[model samples]
Target chain A: MNPADRALEDLFQEVGPERAPSHLHARILAQLADKAEIRTVPAPLLARWQWILIGLAAMGSILLAVMLPGNGSSTGWIALLMDHLPDMTSISSTLRTTLIGGAVISGILYVLDAQLNTRVRPTHG
Target chain B: MVYTVTHRILRNDMDAEEATQDTFLKAIRGLHTFQGGSRFSTWLYSVAYRTAISRSRLRRTEDRSLDEVEGRPGEPGSEAQGTTSDRRRALEHALSRLTPEDAAVVTFHYLHEMSVDEIVTATGLSASNVKVKLHRSRKKMLEILQEHLKEEVWTLRTE
Candidate 1:
């Protein structure tokens, strides 16, 4: 090491370790007490499981909708609407297309918003 | 250690105290991940270093130049006696002129007695980068001492 470096090392050693203010220990203990209180409340497992199940069900519904065979004949609500409202069938096709597109776009936006707002909760190992 | 590291970076007593508190709180919260692969002090210092850096970034306060530091030595001869307190003041003034990162590097390298590898872990810098920064910081500190305590520094160097 150079003389300058040696001089600095000597200076730092002469200074020694600094002592923190006396109250800092007390302050840290107080904060730890407060944190301990907050941590005691266990996370709600049921609510988390419910959200997981809801997500899985939603995903399954989407997959089923995509995988199921598409018959030429209208089924369920569409068949009922077509049977009772034959005069409105032309506009119904355009409206149905618009609603599906809107729903898909809304789902995408919702997922993105959720992702952006999600906070990483600290986990204890 | 936390207080000193934070003070070196923040350059404000109150801010350093607050950052020291935050550092311990973070360490407590993240204790489970410590894994004990290195010395505990090294891990703790790493936490303190990061907290101080983040606090410094958030505040973005302007660092005072060497000339701007209050009670700086007016003449080189004035510091020749260089009592312990005088040496302390000189070091503090010199550290004040350095950037927070450079000060941190010096504090860890010299005061904390951390090895380059330990500093690499603490600061998240590569070995070569830490070496480069350490060299630059040492050079800057030497320059500051030469400017402020020319005779005393030379005497210490020759001793």
Candidate 2:
């Protein structure tokens, strides 16, 4: 190296980088602490297996309802659903309206709850 | 190591400290992604270098000019005259005048004792690019040193 480069190497060794401020260490540790706390709080059960379990239960219910021997017909699942379609319309108007309204409100609330939970959750990188 | 890389780029103690903190946080969060293909220190240096660059860019956008945001070099300490500390302060002042990338390249080459290949890994530059930048940075630092410490350079050259 030339004289100037040698001098700079020496100077840099002497001075080095400044030590980080004490408070910055504290701030980083605090963030890590918050991250650890967030990790420790187990994810909600609904967030983990609720959807899968719901799908499985629905599938099981449909299989049982369609395969029951009392149907007295070798019809496919779609045909069975079509056969029950009239029974669904036979329900009273007030009961049907109330059920449909309740289902819509429940779906909306579930979606909103999921969105709020995601928004509040702490993100890493 | 993080502080050294960040300080070279940011040229401000407070900003360097903030960048260092950010680097650590990012490294921790991204730890699972680390493939262990490089040395841990090299990977950490990469994080610090990128964080410092990002912080510099953010500051530039907010302040409208880098020169306005960089900290003014401190006056040489009187009691430390003619000592190693004096020479260090003079060198630091010169470094402060360099662009952040130039200063970072110089620091990584000299102070960190990083090979050009290692620097290429840290900075994500090609091998030839890293070599070219290192050469340019060295020339710039030499110019700065000669400008700021003419007598000292003369003395060192003679010795």
Query: Mind giving the per-residue lDDT tens digits that candidate 1 earns over B55-112?
Result: 8887773433533565333233454456666667778877877788888888888888
- Show model 1 residue runs off by greater than 4 Å: A36-125, B61-80, B150-159
lDDT, residue B13, model 1: 78
Give the per-residue lDDT digits (tens) of candidate 2, residues B33-115.
78898888888999999999988987866544644676457444445444656667767776776777778877888888788
lDDT string for model 2 (A36-105, tens) is: 3323233443653665565565555455444444444537775666566545334345444564565555
Native interface contacts kept by each candidate, as a fraction = 0.57, 0.55
Choose the strongest candidate by lDDT. Answer: 1
Q: Any runs in candidate 2 off by more than 4 Å, and if so which?
A: A1-4, A36-125, B61-71, B75-80, B150-159
lDDT of 1 by residue, A1-125 (tens): 77766777777888876668999988888877666332333443345456566566556545433323342456776556545643544455555555556557546755654554453453332
Q: What C-alpha lDDT values do all the predictions have? A: 0.72, 0.69
